[model samples]
Every structure is written in C-alpha cells, then in structure tokens.
Target chain A: MNHLLEVNNLEINFKTYGGEVKAVRDVSFHVDKGEVVAIVGESGSGKSVTVQSIMGLIPTPPGVIKGGSIKFQGKELLRASKREMRKVKGSKIGMIFQDPMTSLNPTMIVGKQIAEGLITHQKLSKQEAKKKAIEMIKQVGIPNPEERYNQFPHEFSGGMRQRVMIAIALACNPELLIADEPTTALDVTIQAQVLELMKKLQKDTQTAIILITHDLGVVAETAQRVMVMYGGIMVESATVFDLFENPKHPYTWGLLNSIPNLEGTEKKQLIPIEGSPPDLFSPPKGCPFAPRCKYAMDICLEEMPGDYQIDESHSARCWLNDSRAPKVEMPFTLEKEKTVTVGGESID
Target chain B: MTKNLVEVQSLKKYFKIKSDVTVKSVDDISFYIRKGETFGLVGESGSGKSTLGKTLVGIQAASDGDIIYNGQNIKQLNKEMKRNVNKEMQIIFQDPHASLNPRMRVGDIIAEGIDAYKLFSGKDRTNRIYELLERVGLSPQHAKRYPHEFSGGQRQRIGIARALAVEPKFIVADEPISALDVSIQAQVINLLEDLKVSEDLTYLFIAHDLGMVKHISDRIGVMYLGKMMELSNSDDMFTNPLHPYTQALLSAIPKTNPRDAKRERIVLAGDPPSPTNPPSGCRFRTRCPHAMEVCALQEPQWKEVEKEHWTACHLY
Candidate 1:
C-alpha cells in the first residue's frame, strides 16, 4: 500500500571545519494517511534533519543530502526544483517549528501571514483569504479571531502564539503536518491544550502528522507509531503500545527508564544512559549505541546491525536480537501487574 | 524536628517596569527549607518561581518581609555578616549557555566564588576546582577548556561545579535540568542527588517539570501568579492534591503509558495572566475550572486544610 509520505535510506551530511558530520544515516520510515508518526531522539540525533529534508528546508552550503528518496503522494520530493517544491511546501506539506517566538514573522500581522499561504497556494482572492484566515484562527480555538487578525505576533502569549502557528500550518489544509517540538517551549498545561487542539484538528482534517519530540509522554499521548533514532540512525520502529510495553532497542530502554513515572507511587532511582551521544563528525562503524549499551558484545562494535523484525508491527536494530546471542532480561517494564518475558522466560 | 535551614516569611519582590505599573513577581510568599532537604517549587513561567528563588539566594532583595537563615534575619545582618551568609547560599541558573562567562576558562569560572570569599588561594583553589569537576562527572582536564567547547549537558556540569566551589550549605537549583535532553537530565539529576548527600546540602529545586521535581523533592509547593497555592509532602501532594490549581497542574502532565493516555486532563484555559495586573482575588481563578463566586471576590487564606497539608483555596 502506498503511504502519504515515505523516506528510504535517507543519508544527510554537513560540511564542518574539522570533518564532514554524518547528521543522518540510512534512516527509513513512512506515514500513512491521517496517521500520527513520531520521531523521538535527543539533540544531534538527526530527527530534525530527517523532517527538515522532507520540506526542503535544509540549507545546502553546509548541509548536503548525500543520498535519499523522499516521496510525497508518490512524487519525488528530494529532486524537486525550487518552483516545484514551493507549490508542495505549504499546500501539500506544512511545518511547525520549535519556537513560535522566532518562526512567525514579527513585523507582519499574523492573519496576513496565515493568508499568505492561501493566497499563494490556493490562489484565493484577498478578501476571501482574510475571511478564511480568521476562520482558521477561530478553528484553532483562539479567542476574538477578528480582533486578533490585525494584531502582531508579540501581542499573543506563548500558548496563543503556538495556536496561531497551528492555524497557519493548517490554513491551506495540508495533507501532512510536521511539528518539530511544537510544545517544547510552552508550559505543561498549555502543552496539553495545544496537543489536544492538534489531535482534534487532525481528526477533523484527516491530516497525517510527523511529530518530532524527545518527550516520551507526549509521544505516548499522540503518536500511533514511534521511531526511536540514535546517532542519526533509526534504532527502533514500533507501535506506541509495543514501544512502551516491549521496547526492543537498548537506547529506547534507556529513554523509557530515564523519565520519572508520574503515576508511580514508589520513587524509583532513574537509570540514566551513561555518556553522551556519539560524535557525528566521525561516527562509529558499528551500532551508534554500542558504547552506552550495557549488553554490548564484540560484534556490536565491529559492524552496524541490520533491522531485526520482532513482530509484524515492531522492528529493532540490535545484535542482541540474533538467535546466536544469549537471551537477556529487560531491565525495566511498564506492565507493573504482569511478568515480562524475553525469549520465553518470565521475569518477575 | 529538623531545623529550618532557611525561613522565608511573607517575602515580596516587585519589579517596576513603568513609574506606576509594578510587576509583583514574588508577592507575600512564605516557606521554609529544612536542613539537608530538597524543597521543590513547581510553577509555570510568569508564576514567580524564579523570582522567589532569586530572592531566597539574595540575588534579588525582597521588597517586603523577612528571610531568616539559621534563626537570624538576613535583613538585619551587617555587611560582614551578610557576606558570611551569602557564601552559604548559592544559585544554579536555568540556562547553562547564558549562566557561565563566555571568555573565562571552566577552572576560573568555578574558582570565582572561592576567590570572592577568600576560602582558598593558589594551589588549594586549583585542587578544589579539579575535585568539583570530577565530582560532577567531568574530568579534571575539563578545567582547562572554555564553556563553548562543551555540550549542553557538560556545560550544566560546569555550572554545578561552579556552584559547589563555594561549598554552600544551601543551593537554589532553578530549572537546572530543563535546558538538557531527557537522558542527559537524568545524569545531572543523579549528580545533584549524590552531591546533596555527600556534601551535606539543601536545595531549593525550582522547575516547571512536575515529574522530576516530585522525584527529587521531600516536600513540594505549588505556586501560581506569585502566590503559594499549596504545600505538602511530595507523595501526598501527588496522591491527594488539595488546591484546584495543584490538581489541575498534576492532571495536566502527560502519562507515559499508552494505556493511561486517555485519562482526563484539567487543561487550564488561556495563558497565565500578566503579573503586572494580576487577578484581584485568587490569581488562578480566571483559568481555574472550579472557580467560585468568592474566588473572584476575596483572596483565600493560606491555611492547613489537612494534617501537614497546606492549601489556599475557597474549596478548602
């Protein structure tokens, strides 16, 4: 089945003073129609690069897409010309950045900013675009849409600015919305509201969303499927339930264990993944997570592991998944009531 | 009972932007940090959590009320006595990037406080800086490098090292981990926890992230628009929150488990009001789900609603 968006063998690099930084390497993923797919990773993990390349937003002088095929609705995006990319960018693909403070135009009135995309892509008249922009503002749950239409970005608060961002992204009713850490800047209550708004809008518009965030809780709440990235590589891809209940990669395990459980009664010591991320300037030949992995074998440091299919809906890149390797118990489990089993032996 | 390391009574910090317009950042707030215990302060931006933290550490002078440290009022302290008290209290800022001096070496940044108090000189100061660097998980070799050379996590470690340089009895960690990545945040949190025990330190842990604050703090206080809404034991506050604001704040946190994702969330409406002209009665009433007639008419008194649990709410 054809997906709304598909990325295959995506390799991105940056020219630096010291050496060429391998920002992203051999990453592959897909987003089905109206589905929410999340890319979870820390800083320098290339999650942003993967999505930025989708919208043709990466600058070329320092950033170079060495190899990849980004297909949107079966059309090749990576090789598209500037004019061709422009047509697809706002109309077919919309993006929300991390900071609403800088992303939105400060001088321009926000309503016109929302209307600019509609006027360009849909070729609507000025009056009609104005009417639609106000409607879009209202649709995003912003109060006093008509009054707010004339106001600048500075007039709105952080949460309201994000809401305006949502209004702009969904203005032309794009098929896919890419939100890069959309609520990372907002407070928790405001984040909850914004996430709720996005979910509601997604349900109404049937827009496929690619959410890029490091917060697992946000991923759990919104994403249907999760792609855990490390050292610019896709380490694990699984359904949200499977990712939380039975995460396969050690990197994923470390992420899950590090966050304190809000609902938990007992105060458990956080098991932080020791050491920092791999230096991308000269990335390791083997698994990017091998040095941090406690169960790292000799072969893990020698060669990069291929994708090991755990089930129909889950896959992980790790040497431990090999049949020859010894079975190891998972250090953490989300299922508090039941025993978790790995390779058939139950762990109590 | 454990002695209160620091006691704050009705402390107020107001910033005047205009001649007439006054922003009450920390308004009539009172709390105490027990000896060697972490007191977590949770609130959103513009809620005055940072202002209260700054006031406690003497970075900003309180507009009103008294701050008693070790049973002596800090306001009454002489210049010499104040200097001695200032050395005991230090702060770790939120942004690791902005906190450290860009031109200074990591070693000199850590030694600034040591030199200010004249606690050590020459070889002793160098050794102290090295010891602090290693204690926070960075190697002693890192002292020679500049702040620009380190990552966000490592820069935070340098900040921690600098704070520890003074050998402060009480430290105000103002959203130290908020600037870091999730995995890196845990590493720094563990470092702080370890140092708290070994160095015999008390912390005024201020952050918007409720989950991490709950993990580290013995007691937790919920602040809204420069007022303390609730205060209680960490576990009790989570399980049985009294203030409507606290309940909503707790519920607003996204659940990690997919099964628990659909749980009801009391998402507050609109952004928190500006501190310059805050709501007349209860500061949280404008956005609160359970706002009563009295909520807008009168400010609720801060009283102990339950045993060892304090709340300022009309519901109580």
Candidate 2:
C-alpha cells in the first residue's frame, strides 16, 4: 500500500498549572493514498490532539509534541524547517473543523476564505481565484455558488456552512483532507448531505480523507480503515467490514452495541458503554478501556496486552485476544445481526 | 389513548424583517403531546425546532396559534393564570453551560423554581435540591458548587434538576444531549427516560439525531424550514418514512463503516433558501431530489398515508 501519511510513537503533552497533561501517548496510524481513515474516539481521547499535532495547529507554550515522528509522503514533518512546514500545511494537507462558524471569518465572504489558500499557494489573480472558488463551492453542492460567494458564513445554514468549509479545505487541492467532526453538530439530514458531498468529492478528486469523530455511524460510512482510540491509545485498527463483522476488541463491541441503528426493524435499548471516558489528568495504569470493557481480565488491569494481529491489515490492543486468556463472546445488541451484517451498506 | 397534556394549534411565529418579507420561523405547525408521553421533534438548524420549543414554553410569543396547556390557552390566560401555567411548563436548553447562571450555586439554581412558587422552606430547600441532584446522577453535596465546575454531562444533569425543581408537568427538552459526548449522550438520555417515568412527566423532546429521538420518543415529528414535514409513530417513521426529505435524511446518516467510507454519496445540492424569501409552495422543494414542477408552484397538503402516519410531501 502506498502510504500518504504515517505517524510513529506520537506522544503529545500539555504544560498545565498543575503538571504535564499527557494528551496523546504512543499513538501510531497511517493513511494510504486515496484512502479514507477514521480516528474514532470520545472527547479527551486524544483524537483532536493527534491531528492538531499533524497540522502544527496546537499552541506550543501549553501544548508540545513531546516525542513523535510524522512523515507525509516519506518527508518528516516534525523535522522540517518553518519554510518547509508552510509548504506542506495548505499545499499538500487540508483540514476542515467541527465548527464552521468559528473556522470561517464571520466578516469575510465564503468565497474569499477558499480563494485565500489558492491565491497564497497557487498565486492566482482575483478573477481566477473567484472563478475557482465558485467551482469548488458548486462541487461541494452549495447551491448557486456564484451568488453564495458573496454571502458571509452566518448567511449559510449549518449544512451549507459546512459545505463552504469543505470547499475551502479542498481549494488548494491537497492530497489529504483532515476533517474533525465535520458533521457532528449538524442535523442528521444535513449531516448526511455533508457526508455524501465529502464522499463524492473524494471519489471525483481521489483525495485521501482523515475523519475524526466519536460517532460510530460516521465511521461505518466514510472510513476504509478505522483507528479506534481510547486514552491516547489505539485500541483497534481494521477494515470496516473486519472491524464491524468480526470485531475482536471488547471496546469495539461496546461501541457496536451503543450505536442506535435507525434503519433496523428493532429499537433495541442501546446498552451504552458504562462509565465515562478515562480522565486525562490522572491517566489510568494499564488499558484505559479495561474499566468499561465487559471482557476485562486480570491481565487487562495489571498489564496492557501487546498488539494482537488479526491479519496483515487488522490489529487490536486487548488482553482478551491473547490465546491464553479466557474466550468469552460479548453479546451483540442488533436485532438481525445475522442477515444485516454484509448488506449493512450506506444509508444515503 | 389519553387526554392531551399540551395542545398546539396552527402555531405560527413570524418575524418582520426590515424588508416586509416575513421570516416564518414556525409556519402553521401543529402537534400535541399526550399526558406522560414523549413527543420527539427532529429537524436541522433553522428548521425551527428550538423556535417551536420556546413558543410552547411561552418564552417566545406565537404570532398565530393557540397553546392550550391543561385546558386554557396560555396566551389568553390572566396574569396570575399565566404565571401558574408558566410554572407548570419548563424548558431545558441546548447549551446547559450558557443556560445556567454562573454566579448562582447549583442548589439555588435548582431551587429557583421552588422558591418562585414559595412552596418550600429554607430548611426543606436544601433537601429538595439534594434529591433532584441525586436523581439526575449527581452527588447531593455537589449542589454547593458552581456550574463551571461540572463537566458537559454533569452540567446538563444540573440543568435537568433545575427544570424538574418545580415538578413541571410538561418539559420542552431542546437538543439537551447534542452538546455532550456520544457515550455520555446515552447516559443523559437514559436519565431523562427514568425521570419521565418516575415523575409521570410529558416531554417535548426536540433533537436532530433520529436514532436518539426514536429511542426515547413515543412519536417523532420531522421538521423542515419551520414546517412539520412528517409525523408518525417512532417505529413506523424508521420503518416506512414517506416524506422525500425524511427518506433522504434517513439515508444520509453516515453508516458506521470505515472501509466503504469513500463511496458515492447523495449530497443534496445547494443551501436551503432563505426563510424570509422562501421559495413558493414547499419550503424543501428547492433542495428535494424528487422535486417537481408542481412542487415549486403548490404546497402539498399534510395528510395521513396510514392510520396516524402523517407526512407532507407531493409524492406522498
């Protein structure tokens, strides 16, 4: 596989008033060329911090990438000079955020935000940039992109503003696009629209996408491979089918159980994963999910299990995967799990 | 099956933009919540779910509507009667952090309703507040702390306690869990369910998450641009959604698969037209994938396709 981006032992820390807050710890994942990878986790699970570290968006005084290696197309990002980092930031890597209201300048027109990146990088003239901006917006499914070009962010609906955000991110035609919960705040219908737009754009442009979200439904629709994170650690990483159908990790099972499938015939009361996400302040001793995992063993609490490889492309961190550990299948909550596994295709 | 706890009839809220183009925030939307039942209203931002919420709670005046709480129109109530009706109707806002006052302690915030009604003594106030805190999964002692000290989930719990303080019969919960984490969203929802049953409460739960809405509601109402696009039993809505908007919405939810993430998606083209200058006929006609020439010129009548399953779409 041709990897577009790769990270190794990415450890990020924040210097707080009390002490150093370990945001991300020994996290590693790779995105392949033209592939869509989802980094799924709840808030404070280091999903955001890891990506911020990627774009060098985190404020260094309080936040620091203590130790890590970020390589994009075989070029080291952390080791790159300021000039080199600038070339890579918008030229090769694009990013869209959760809140478009904040991501976009309220005073500026939507077209300008998109054109800024193009003009800055491609050095296009005002007329050329405007034309491309409208085209990009139209491609993202924003209605009447030319008229909407002059409209401010507030003038657009939540779904439309998100579309604008996508247009701006793809303005420079980067190889990789990192969207942090692009649709979390949107309504289901609007969220669906944005997700569809993203998928279509990716198909048309063959742009690799890194989607970071807590919603498992999003993971199922938009990711080719998923990296399930908890407490700054990758709990599981596998192909979408492999992860959902033959889910190895107990945490993944917990997530699967928690997903409220609207399309299904049964309205099974979601057996939510008990307990809160592990606190980042005083980090847990071993596996962060051990407290919430239904199949936690003595080894899980005392010593975190090493990687258990399912296949060349699939891996998980859980003691239950060990051959010596007890074999216990966690009960699934889906009504028609047998029939609904394979054709559990896209809802939209 | 039972007498309605809250009745909304032709509820319309319109604002006069400086240009005389009326921005219909809630345009002729009507629904009723039965006693002790949860009526879930689902919609996108600008779909006016929150506007309907505020109108029902009497926080925002309805331009043309009758909000009959109990047996009286709240708008027509006398000053004293209005106060009494207001006391029985409470709302839990989307952002709990902003909804709650920072300076006030949690106990006082919760007890404000109790205090307003002059129902509890100073000595009993603490106990009542304590009871509410514990009921919402917070420690009784946490009442002494400020809102800022609580996490997003905990803050929402505090907000719930505050609403339940007066023992309101009907609660308008507007996107209460949308701001919380997914894992915690379920917890808060479960807590709300428990509270509704234990207290014999009627709830108007408004949210954008169809799954969560279906999980807790007896009936779900799908809204688009201030109109009730579809209304049906929770089970039926998911099983056989009739409205084009509803079907598209149901389909649009990103499936939880990582491998097929980049598949061909049906993204609706264009932004929703401005409400002030809404397109003729159907509000959703401009963005409807199945929209027709008739759709642009004439609005569809809201009719029942099956027993108790009502949808507003030309095709339906």
Q: Tell me, by DockQ, which candidate is best.
A: 1
lDDT of 2: 0.84
Q: What is the lDDT of residue A120 in candidate 2?
A: 87
TM-score winner: 1
User: What DockQ, on C-alphas, does every prediction get?
Assistant: 0.82, 0.54
Q: What is the lDDT of residue B234 in candidate 1?
A: 96
Candidate 1 positional error at A345, Å: 24
Count of backbone collisions in candidate 1:
0
Q: Which is the leading candidate under lDDT?
A: 1
Q: Candidate 1, residues B86-158: lDDT per residue as tens digits? A: 9999999999999999999999999999988888998998899989999988999999999999999999999
Error of 1 at B155 (Å): 1.7
